[model samples]
Target: MYGVQINDDGTIEQMNDELAQACVNGLKNLEIHNYPQPINMEVSLLSIFCGFYGTSNETISAEGIGNIRKFNKLSANADKNYGQASSNGERKPNPWILTKILRYHNKDHYEQIIKPLLKKNYEGKKKEKQIQINQTLILNKIDLTDDFTQLDMQEKAANGEYEKEEQIVMDLTRILIYYEGETEDIYAIKGYDAICDTQVLYHKLEGTVYKQLEKININFKNKKIDEKDNSKPITVKHIFKKYASKFFKKRCKFISEDPKILTVFQGYKYKKLHTIDYECLQMYFYLIKETIAAGDERVYEYILNWIAWLIQNPGKNRELQQYYKVDKVQVKIDSLM
Candidate 1:
């Protein structure tokens, strides 16, 4: 029933070629609604599955045929464990892992199609990997995909379609600098969220897509001033009076020409800073000249709070973001067929 042949020697072997021909013959001999019908491309994958399952000995009954696609024994014992330990040593499964496993079979189907159809164009050689397959795929000989958006980014990411957020932050910082407009209604307007907004942000891009990554749940509690200074919001004037220059000043390389001077080293490697960004000195002068809340005092207070966050938490102070040399991962691509 499973398209396997049993020999007199009690050995079993696959009979795929014979079964495929038999299936074609069986369909040719069948008459649906008193009309002879021949198989065509209109035969859906589910229809083929139903035919196969209906022929199986276990699912020959009507109830068995109906329940063929349903899951049973839905209990802990039947629960097949999946996923592996994450970076933080917690076992968690990416939501789409099962779907990705199914797509793995698509590669086999793709290679089969490519051999018969695109064999002449690609010189009859099938690439071993997806990265290699991408070379031939760009020839535009076919658009087998249902739509341009058919490639699922979430699923592809699991199959190595994504880079770490930490690396992306460093890469973007080198190419673009924050420039505030000279006045209110002009070129670039700065936007902020009171809760999540720090003095900095980073963005990443792929093709026409862009994503902003930010540090969440930061320790924003300001340092107490002589016990009576409950952590209420301080004015720009109060910010200038204390905790502005002392904690910062020498640590101001974040605003300087080279931010890489801020790279804080651990035992062997630098700490990976994923989201946090910094205001540069050029932007500082830009902000002061533009003027806001009680003169340039507001700008000073923003920088002060940023510096305090870095200083107070011994974990944060690392170099300014190193976006200098372009990373090879971006420019590098395999030479395709």
Candidate 2:
């Protein structure tokens, strides 16, 4: 499924053109159903998988796919072994080692080449390594979790979960700071469980969309609290501000300022942020805000939580459409070929 060639020497080859073209064709054909018009777009499986997994790493290039193919069997075995090890709280066959093997594609040399090298590097310096990690988290204002205290962070980092959490924390901090002008205490809102509460709130509000509820009021102060300390409550109102019209416009302007960022959004058309797109997105913010401002507490909570979740986890947009059983925004092309 990973699109790449595995060489006999355990080197990974870039994706072949024919397969890429075929996959693009498939997605482009689906444009009539729910994709945007002018269905000419390049789709990257590596990008898709990374997004699906909530990974921020763009380093999973086509070559990485080949690297993964080499020891698909070994990875499965490692995963099974890792599961058992984790349940028993033993740290044998660290997932990071498996990850290194996959990325470098050196199954044969892992014992002779990789293990010994890593052992030499990390054997006597465990506490020092952990201290550095703890210091980095402190600098970022991310809470030092039990995972960080233990070896769980390193293990989860191998699979990108820990990295994903850090990015999410950073994004949340930025959102809070953008609205409140400082992340004085928001740094306490760290880790997956904390973020998952917002994710779950998103799903709950999504379900309420089908129901015609004109009432919505949300006491944000009560629902979400800093997991690290129940004493410090995170101001969830700042999260709602993230989806405010001003924020969307500012974000659009900021994103448009960078050529590379624009390229990612504009795609084949190479167009700048169009007035229509901006207005539509702004209108979405307005409608959502109006609903929450006028509706019941539960509705406000769900919408705000969903908005917060979207800010950090953007890959779920496609899945959101599926959950709602609807196509993405359908704009009239107003042209006939």
Candidate 3:
């Protein structure tokens, strides 16, 4: 006696009995059957089972068995292609397979996989269709307006909701560079202004416009005094006090605001300036571009300073900085200015 379960697609789901016995040497000797959980047996019976249950009078034959063997071979090849096969040519459990199994074994898991994939596929297809439906939207838009506003471009982009093809990515890069410039204005402005303002505040609090010059002298005196008598110069306390007052004033200003946006902005500025280098500015631009592309608008003041930093540093970091050299920086600044 043999039993099988098959999907509507004629794919094997499970098998049992004489065929299983032949494949695993003897069904009775198999330890899997006595276990609490059901065991899977590989056999050609699933297609046979589907054929038997169907309205057709077709019977399973030698050719049907051969077809099952072909399916198994093709499945093995697919598994191998996905690196889900062991060196011994046995298929190993993988996320893709496990996902399928979980879908079959549990309703929640089934919904989890089906819902997301179905939603994503449907949304992608829907957007593609909408683009065709509104085929002349961009053309009509350009005809109506002499200059394309950000809002207009955004609406087109939303309707054009086509997946970003590689060529489109290049085109987008060119367009973004042509009008908007390579670097982001908000990021450059915020970063540049924050650093400058902080420096200015430090100078004002210190009662000296030449704090850096005074610090250099104090550093020299400390070095010389240490060399002579191993006594550190007392100028250290004066320098520390001057800077500490500025630090406290900044902190007081920061804390004076409502805890949400002000706190976040201060922290963001601090992190941005802590490592104010070419790489940092480049990364900041990347994030800004992504945010804008995603239609998010949360501008911060530090963006200006970020641009200035990019202009100043260009690419002196250990890693490659050719893309952010002085020429590039100057071009970026010119765009924002």
lDDT of candidates 1 onward, in order: 0.27, 0.30, 0.29
Off by over 4 Å in 2: 1-57, 60-62, 66-107, 124-337
- What TM-score would every model get versus the actual structure? 0.14, 0.15, 0.17
Q: Candidate 1, which segments miss by more than 4 Å at Cα?
A: 1-40, 44-168, 179-337
State the lDDT of candidate 2 residue by residue for 18-107, as single tens digits. Answer: 323222222211101111122124222222222212211224323333333342333334333433323342321112222232223333
Best by TM-score: 3
- Please provide, for model 1 over 141-228, each residue's C-alpha lDDT reduced to its tens digit, 9 standing for 90 to 100: 1111112211232233334433322222222222222222233211111122245422222222221121211211112232223322
The best-first sequence of candidates by lDDT reads 2, 3, 1
Clashing pairs in 1: 259-320, 262-318, 262-319, 263-319
Q: Once model 3 is optimally superposed onto the true structure by TM-score, how far is the C-alpha of residue 279 displaced, in angstroms? A: 55
lDDT of 1 at 241: 22
- lDDT, residue 312, model 3: 62
lDDT score of residue 281 within candidate 2: 76
